[model samples]
Target: MAGVAGNQPLYICRNCKNPIALRSDLLSKAFIGKYGPAYMFSHAMNIIAGQKEDRKLITGAYSVADIYCCNCGEILGWKYLRAYEMQQKSKEGKFIIETAKIAKEY
Candidate 1:
């Protein structure tokens, strides 16, 4: 959490339970990428899998703020952007060290 960012280099997909390791430089882009950005995240994060039933979704669609499920490609969680209000309140007057750590790689 000193140099890169604290997102955990590895996270088990909550959907399929697959090991989701952060890819190297090539696809380091942050939409489900290594350096997660604000837009790639969803305010409401959850995991689910289902097919379309009668032209409708089997698993009601949800959202995530930060990461995605490596197995099912479903959104898993979210991160509070610096501009996000709730985070500002929680981390108010605190220092944020923007660096990558074992728990936050991708």
Candidate 2:
């Protein structure tokens, strides 16, 4: 949070208003989640990653962990721990945050 520019927008937890990610860290808005549209981010903050598990996502099989808002305990999204396929390896270490779980704060 400290490195973010003062004017940069933020994505905050809808339930707790805790700063979750910076707009500059957003990588893509074309991702999908369990509920609906999701986003991929290069980095996230104020979050707690749950247990890692192997899940077959739309893209492929991956080791992911559900991320929660540290302040409110709301399930925000999942972080990609590992990608089984070579083509999907680029997604490793990235964050997938559901659009419905976060809001933009300008």
Candidate 3:
């Protein structure tokens, strides 16, 4: 069955831990034929979490914190993928330590 984004539940950003409203324009354009299952499954069941550098440890420190909604300031999920460390880990370590696709909205 095709999932409708309009009728689907949207969670806030997991990073900031704030509420985020669905981006209507992006959502509408994302789905196919009004409301597509693939698009809804991808968005509704997906959470984009990003990590940032902490400039206070004297050394580079990254927190597994930060989840922001594209539409609004809300946290959806937390991840360890920092833009600086995105490609700094080995294959096994990357898989074991890093989280590519984190958890979903509850």
Candidate 4:
């Protein structure tokens, strides 16, 4: 894990409190996941991406990989592997982490 300055807030795994992503990397909070509300982030750390698979979501069809917390192995959300539609291509390489799986740290 990378060293985060004390002043910077970050998101941590709810299960194990493992540093997952920085608050500054958050892009949007208006996303929905398999469980419920989720957040979109430009980057994520301390995570493992599972196998890529095609899924039909509300937005469109996408190739995504389930993301897991490296420490506890809990399912956090998913990473956008590929976007089938050109319009959604920007989401490629982004991460969608369910709110229920993480907590904000100050």
Point out where model 1 deviates above 4 Å: 1-11, 20-66, 84-106
Model 2 per-residue lDDT tens digits across residues 14-87? 99889999999999999999899999999999999999999999999999999999999999999999999999
1 or 3, which is superior by TM-score? 1
Question: Model 3: runs farther than 4 Å from truth?
Answer: 1-51, 55-65, 82-106
List the global CA lDDT of all models: 0.30, 0.95, 0.31, 0.95
TM-score of 3: 0.24
Candidate that would win on TM-score: 4
List, residue by residue over 7-83, the lDDT tens digit for candidate 3: 53443334543323333312222222112221222122233455553322112343444444554544433333332
Task: Give candidate 4 regions above 4 Å deviation.
Answer: none
Q: What is the per-residue lDDT of model 4 for residues 1-106, given as tens digits with 9 covering 90 to 100?
A: 3366367889999999999999999999999999999999999999999999999999999999999999999999999999999999999999999999999988
lDDT of 1 by residue, 1-51 (tens): 212324535333444545433322122223322343312211121233233
TM-scores, all candidates, are 0.25, 0.95, 0.24, 0.95
Arrange candidates, best TM-score first: 4, 2, 1, 3
What's the C-alpha lDDT at position 93 in model 3? Answer: 12
Stronger candidate by lDDT (3 vs 4): 4
Clash totals in order: 15, 0, 12, 0
- Best-to-worst order by lDDT is 4, 2, 3, 1
Locate the minimum summed-lDDT window of 10 residues in model 2: 1-10
